[model samples]
Target: MKKIKNIRYPGKYGLLWVIALFCTGTIAFAQSGSDTTDTGMAEVSIELKYTEANNKTKILEAAVKTKVEGSWQGANGVAVQFYRNEAAPEQLLGTVTSDNNGVARMILPEGEEKNAGPEYTYIAAIKNNERFEDTEEEITVAESAFEMTLVEEDSVRQVHISLQTSDADGQEIPVGEVEVSLFVKRMFGLLPISDDPETTDENGEVMAEFPADLPGDTAGNLVIVARIEDHERFGNLEFSRKINWGIPLVIDPEKDKRQLWSSRANAPVYLIVMVNSMLVGIWGVILYIVFQTYKIVKLGRSKAAADTV
Candidate 1:
C-alpha cells in the first residue's frame, strides 16, 4: 500500500511560494488606496510671533493657515479660528476668513492667551465644511528668553545654548535635534560665528567653541547672540547675552600715541595739533597785551615822581 500516495510534492519550496504570494497580495492591498481619488489629506499650520509693546505689553500674533494638496487652495473660505485649548466650547478668538492664500491671522491680547508657559499651548482649527473635512492643529511656543552659558577653562572656552521648550502647560521639555545659529555683535552688525549652523543633541543642548580672535568691548566684553531663525516649528526667535569672552582692544601708549580707540592715550594727531595750536596762539596774544600795559604803568609812575620832585 506504499503505492505513491498521490505522488504529492511536499517540498519546502512549495511552501515558500505560497508565503510569497500571500505577502505580495497583502502589500498590494495596503498601497492600493494611493491610486484612489478619495485619499486626499488636508493640513493645518500655525505660526507665532511675539513682540513687546513698550516693554510692558506682551503681544502675540498668530498666523493660521489651511492647506490642501500642498497648497492653500484646498481650504479656501474655510472658517479658521485661533484659541487656547480649553474646556467647554473652547475660547473663540476672533473668527477669520481663509483668504485665497488659505491663511487667517489674528492677534491675541496680552494676558488673554499666554503661551509663555507650556500649559498654554494654542490651537488652530477649521470647522468641517462642505468643501473639506474638519481639521485642527495645535501649537506650542516657548518664551523667547533663551538662556546661554559660557565656560572657559585651560584656554578651552566653550559656549552652549540650551534647547528646552515649554509644553502647553509651561512645563520644560527637552527638544531634540534642532538647528541653532550663533552670532557675535560687532560695531556694524551681527557677524556670523560659524558658516554652518549647529544642531542640538539628545540632551537638548548645542555647543560650540569660542573663537579666540573674536573682538569684544574695549574691556573685552562681547554681546554674543544665539538664535533659532526660521524654524518650521518654532518660527524666528533670538536671544542676545553679554559675555566677556573676547580680546580687549590693545593700545600701546609709547610707540603709538592714544588714538580714538584707546581711552588711556590722547586724542587723534589732527585734533591735538589743532587744539594745542589755538591755545598757544591765544596765550601769546594775552601775554603781549599784559606786558605793554605794565610798561605804560611804570612810565606814568616815573613821570609823576619827577613832577613831584
Candidate 2:
C-alpha cells in the first residue's frame, strides 16, 4: 500500500488574503501618484473699488484672497495691476503690491477726475504666479458727485446733501428720487444720523437735522459724510468734510492720576502700601527665625561648657 501525504489547497480564507493584499497595493500606488501630480492652482478672488474722496482724489483699491481648504485667506505680498476702460487700449493706471491684509491701492492723478465717460470701467489683475492662476476683476461705475454742507440757524443744526450724475457730455445733472445717506465718521465706523432713509427730490437735495450733543475731538471738529449707496447706474459715491459742529469734549485733568491701569510711576497709593506691608511681614518672619536659631546654638554651647567644667 502506498502512503499519501496530506495535501491542502487555498480555500475562501486564501482568496480573502489575496484580495486584501491587492487592495493595499492599489491604495499605496494611488497615494504615491497623487503626491507627485499637480493638485491644480488655488482658487483666487479679487475685489476692486473706485473711491473719490476729499479734494477730488481718485483711488483704486484691489483686495486679493485665495481659498485654502475651504476657507478664504488673504494673499499677502501679491502684485496687482490697475487698468482703466477696455483691454485693447487699456490705460495702465498703476501697479501695487498687497499688504498683509491683501489690499493694494493706487492713487490716480488729479487729472483723472475729469476723464469720466458714459461708463467708467476699472480692472484689477494678477498674472504669472505659481500658486495662483491668472485672475482679474472688473467693476463698472458711473460718474457721480456727492456734496455735503453744514448750516446752523437759530440754535438748530442741519446737514445739507446733494447728489448728481454726469451726462455723456460730462455735464452735471441732478439725480432725483434716489436714496442718500448722512453719516458721522467715528473711530470704527460711520454713525447714521438720519432717522429714516432720505431720498433726493427733484433738485437732488435732502436735508437732515443734526444732533447737537455728539462728542467730537478737543477742537470740536466732526466729519460729516454724504453718501449715495448702490445706485444701479452710479454704484457708490461719497463726500465728507470736517467742520466745527460737534460738542467740545471735556477732558478731566486728573484722568491719568494714580490708577490701576496707569504706568508704574502712576501706581495707586493703596496698592503700593499693601505690597510694602507684605514684604515687610515676610522679612520680619525670616529675621525672627534666624535670631531663634542663633540663641539655640549659643545656649547649647553654654550647657556643654558647664558640663565639661
Candidate 3:
C-alpha cells in the first residue's frame, strides 16, 4: 500500500516535473536567446498571442498574454512594453499593464518600412522581474490598398466591372484573379445580380450581365453597383453606373385601369388638342408673314432692274 501511494500521480507538481524534464535541454537554449531572461525555475512562463490583427488608421495592434504555473489562468497585473524593430532604431511604442484578465495590448505605428513589401515587425516583451521570467514575442504586418470601376455596353447589353490597384501611382494597373461582387440598385435595397464574384482576368476586368427584370420608373432607369469588402489591403471599395434596363413601373394597384401611367401621365384630350391647334395657328401666321416679306423683296428687285435699263 505504501509503495503504491508513492508511485501514484504527483498531482500538479508531477506534471511540472515531467515538463521540466522534457524542456531541460531547451531551457539552456532559451537562456542564450535575447527573448528570454535567466529564470531561476521553469514553472513560470510568458506566452504571446500577438497574432490577432486589427487595422484602424495607420497603426497595427497585437495582444500579449502571460501565465504562471499552478495558477488557474493568466498572471495578472504584469507590466509589458511594445516595440517596433526596423534595423538599428528599435522604437518603444508604449507600456501597458496587464488587465484583470491578464492581457496586455501593444501597437505598431505608421505602416511604412524600408523593405520591399514595407512589412512592419513588432515585439511585445515583459521586462525582467523578481516574480516571473522575462519573455518576448514578435509578429509582422504589411500595407495594402484597392481600386475598382464599372463599364457598360449598350449594343451587347452587358456590364463589365473592372478591378485594379492604384497603390503605387494613380494609374489603373491590372490585377488578376481578384473576387468582385455585383449588385443592381432597387427602390428599397440593392438586388444581387451576380450569384458569385467574378474573378478578374489578366487585364483586371470582370464581366457580368446587368439584370433587367427589376421594376424601375416609367423610363426604366436603374443603376448597377460593384463592391469589394473586408479585403486585407484595400478594405472596402465600390463603384456604380446608371442604365436604362429595368421593367416599366406601374403605380396603379389594379390592372386594366385605362391609365397611361401614374398621376403624372394623365392628360385631358381637349387640353392636348387645344395646345396643338394654337401651335399650328401661330406657325401658320408666321409663315404668311414671311411670304408677304418675300413678295415685297421680289417686286423691289424688279423695279430696280427696270430703272437700271
Candidate 4:
C-alpha cells in the first residue's frame, strides 16, 4: 500500500467556515439595525415642489417626492394631504400616495381658494397610521385690469355701450353663460326703458344696447347696472362712464357727400405737401448758392488776368 499523506479533517474546516459566516452576518445586522420594534420606525424624507400656470388667478399645482430607506419601505402606504393654511376652515386641495419611485402629484383649482386672501399659503402633510409630517409654502395672486370695448355700432344716435370683464391675468373667465342683470331703472331713474338683462361673451364682455326709441329721451342722463351669478352686485373691475345718447342731430346731404377736396383737407395730406415744398425749396436754394459761387470765382479769375496785363 502507498503511504497515505496526512489529511486535514473535512468536519473541522467546515466548522471554521460556518463560524466566519455567522460573525459577518452579526456585524451586518448590528450596523444596519435590521431588527425593529413596534414603536421604532425609520424616518422618511420628503420633498415638495410647487408651480402655477396662471399667477394672476388663484390656480396652483404641487408635486411631492418621497424617499424611505429600503428597510422601511413597507410604510409607504402613508396618506398625503394637501392643505391651504392652518386656519380652521383650511381648504383640502388633493391627496395622493407614493409610487414605487416614491413620487406624488396634486393639482389645486382656483375656485377652491376663492375666499382665500390675495396671498395664499399652502401646506402638505404626510401621515402614516400614527406618525405625521407636514410642510408649508406661500403663493401670491397678481391683480389685473379689465379690458372694455364697444361691440355694437350706432351712427344715428351716437349711443354705444361696451362690455367689460375682469380677469386675474390673461385667462378669460366664461361670462357668456353668466347672467348679468342690468339696473337701468336704478341708474337712470327718470329714463323710461324696458328690461336690460344681457349675457356676457366668452371674453367676458356684454353688449348693453341703448334703444333708438325712447320716451322723450332727448340727451337724457342714464344709469346701468351689471350683476353675475348669485353675487348681489357686479365687481368694480373697471371705471364707469356717464353718457347722454341723444345730441344735436344734423342731417346734411352735402356734409355726408364724398368730396375729394374734403378728403385732401386731412392733416396727413397737409403734412405731405409741406414736406415736399420744403424739400423743393431746399434744393432750389442749394442750386442758387452753387451758381452764385461759380460766377464769383469766374469773375475773380478774369479780374486777376486783366490785372496781370
Candidate 5:
C-alpha cells in the first residue's frame, strides 16, 4: 500500500508516453522523405561534340556540354580531358563551372600531330569528391599535305627527250597534245639546233621522240638542248645538257661470222662461186649441141647434091 501511494496519475503517464511515440514516428518519417527527395534529384552527365574544320593545318573544334539527370546535380568547376589513342592518357584540356542549366562549354586544344589516318580522341569529365565520371568522343585526323617531284631519264634517241614526273599529292595533270621539240649540234659539226619541246600529261610526265638521224659511223657524243613550255599554264622553262650517245659495239664481226657459218658445209663465198660456174658450164654444153646439129645438116646436104649429079 505504501509503494502504490508514490505512483502519479496513470492517465498523465499514458499521455506522456503517447506524445513521445508520436514525436519519434514523425522524426523517422521526415528522415525517410528527405532521403527520397535526394534520390529524386538529377545525376551528373557529360556529352561531347566535335568537328574538323580545317584539315590542312591539323586543327579541330569541339563543343563540350554537361548535363544532370535523376537526382545528382553536377558540382561546380568541372574539367574536360582530351586524349589521343597513341598519346599520353587523361590530359586536362580545360575547366569550366556549370551554369544554372547544368551545361558547360569548353574548347579543347589541338591534339598531337599525326600522319595520314584518324589521329585523336576526346573526353569530358566531372569530378565528385575523389571519384570522376567522363564521356568519350572520337576525332579523325586527315591525310598529310600534297607534294610533287619530277625525274627525267636520259634520252636514247634524237627525238624530243622528256623527263618522267610525278606528284606526291597524287593529282593527275594533262600531258597529251602538248608541244615537244629539241635542238642539238649536228653529229658531224658544232651547229646548235633549236626548237625542241614537249608537253606534260595529267601525271606531269612527257615522252617525246627526237628525229635526229645519228650515223652509225660517227662518235656517239652529242649535246641535248630542250625547252619546255606549258601552253595552258604560266610556267615556261628551258633545259640543256651534254649527253653521251656513243654506245660501245658489243659484237666482233669476224667472231660473229665464224659462229654463224660453223654449221654450214661450204664457205658462203665458195658456194656462190660454185653455183655460178655450174650455170656457165650448162650454157657451154647447150652451144656444143647446137653446133653438132648444124654440121650434120651440112653433111646431109652435101651427100644429097652428089646423088643429084
Candidate 6:
C-alpha cells in the first residue's frame, strides 16, 4: 500500500506537469500568430530614374509598388519627394504625386546640373504613408549627353549621333565603344529606325542612313529619338529632333464610307435593307394569319344560323 501511494503521488504530479507544458506551448503559438498578423502591413518598393533629354532637359522619376498576395502592384496616389542629396536639410528638388501607374515625375529646370559634379546622386522618398512603410531609393548617375544631327545629301538621308561625358572641368569628352539606339516615335510606341545596332566609334559618333520612304504625319514631320539605355556609367540619356524627312500619309475619304466596321449610325445600306425586309415579311405573315382566323369565325357563325333554320 505504501509503494502504491508513492507511485500515485508522482503519477498525479506527472499528469499535471504534462498539462502545464501543453498550456505553455499553446500560449507561445498564439503569441507568435499575433506577431505574424501585426506584420501584415504592405511592403512597398521604390524605383528612381534619372533622364536627360532634348534641349538640356533633365527629369527625375520614381515608381512606387506594393506587395499584394505575393505579387507587386502599383500603389497609386502616393506622394514622392525628390532631392539632389540624401543629407539633411536635404536639397529638395520637388515633390510630386504618383499617377495611375504609380509613377511620379519632376522636371528640373535648365542648367540645374551645371554645378552638379561629374557623379550626381538623386534620392526619392515616401514619408508617413499609412498603407505602406516609409521607403526611399537613390541612384548615382554620371553626367552624359547625346548630340544628334540630321543630314540629307543627294536624296540620301543620314543621322549622326554622338555620345559624350563631362570632363573634370565640365568639358565634353567622347565616350567610345558604347551602343546607341535610334527610334522614331509612333502613335503608340517607339519604332526602331535601323536594322542593326549602332555603336560609337573612337570619336564617340555613329551614323546610320535613314529610311526615306517611312510614313509620317500629314505634314511629313518625324520625331527622331537617339538613346543610350541602361548604361552602367551614364544611365539613360536621350535626344530628339523633329524634321520633315518622311513621306506624307494622306488618308483616303473612301475609308469613311459605310461598311461593316462602321458605327451603328453608319451601318451599311445593304445591312439596313435586309433587316427592314425581314421585319416586314414577319409582320405580313402575322397579319395574314389574323385575317384567315376572322374569315373562319364568320363562316362558322353563318353555318350555325343555317342549322337553326
For lDDT, the strongest prediction is: 6
Show where candidate 2 strays beyond 4 Å: 1-39, 88-90, 261-264, 276-309
Q: What does candidate 1's lDDT look like per residue over 1-309, in tens digits?
A: 001111123345656655654567756435422221222223344444543322234434445454433454323466666656531255766667765655565656656745335434555555544333345555554443355788888989788887676666666777778888888988888999999888888878887997988777679999887877655555455666787888897765564665776454566878778888999999999999999999999999999999999
TM values, all candidates = 0.43, 0.73, 0.35, 0.28, 0.25, 0.74
Model 3 Cα lDDT, one tens digit per residue, 166-205: 4443445676777777777776888887678878799877
Question: Candidate 1: worst 10 consecutive residues by lDDT?
Answer: 1-10
RMSD, one per candidate, in order: 25.2, 15.2, 27.8, 25.9, 38.2, 14.0
Ten-residue segment with the worst summed lDDT in candidate 4?
1-10
Candidate 5 wrong stretches, greater than 4 Å: 1-42, 54-77, 86-91, 96-103, 108-111, 129-309
Q: Pick the candidate with the highest TM-score.
A: 6
lDDT, candidate 5, residue 8?
Answer: 19
CA deviation > 4 Å runs, candidate 3: 1-155, 167-172, 253-309
Clash number for candidate 1:
9
Clash number for each model? 9, 0, 0, 0, 29, 0
**Candidate 2 per-residue C-alpha lDDT over 121-217 given as tens digits, one digit per residue, 9 for 90 to 100:** 7778886665565777777877777788889999899888887777888888988999878888999999998666789999889888898889988
- Looking at candidate 6, what is the lDDT of residue 227? 89
lDDT of 3 at 140: 50
Off by over 4 Å in 6: 1-40, 87-90, 263-265, 276-309
Residue pairs whose backbone atoms clash in candidate 4? none
Q: What would the per-residue lDDT of candidate 4 be over residues 1-309, giving only the tens digit for each residue?
A: 111112122343555555654667766436534342222322344444443321223323333332233443433445556666641234676776655555555656656656443334555555443432233333332222233322335454322223333354534344444444443333235332336446556665555555654322334544432333222122222223344543323455675444544565443555677889999999999999999999999999999999999
Model 4 misplacement above 4 A: 1-39, 55-77, 87-90, 130-309
| lDDT over C-alpha atoms for residue 294 of model 1 | 100
Clashes of 2: 0
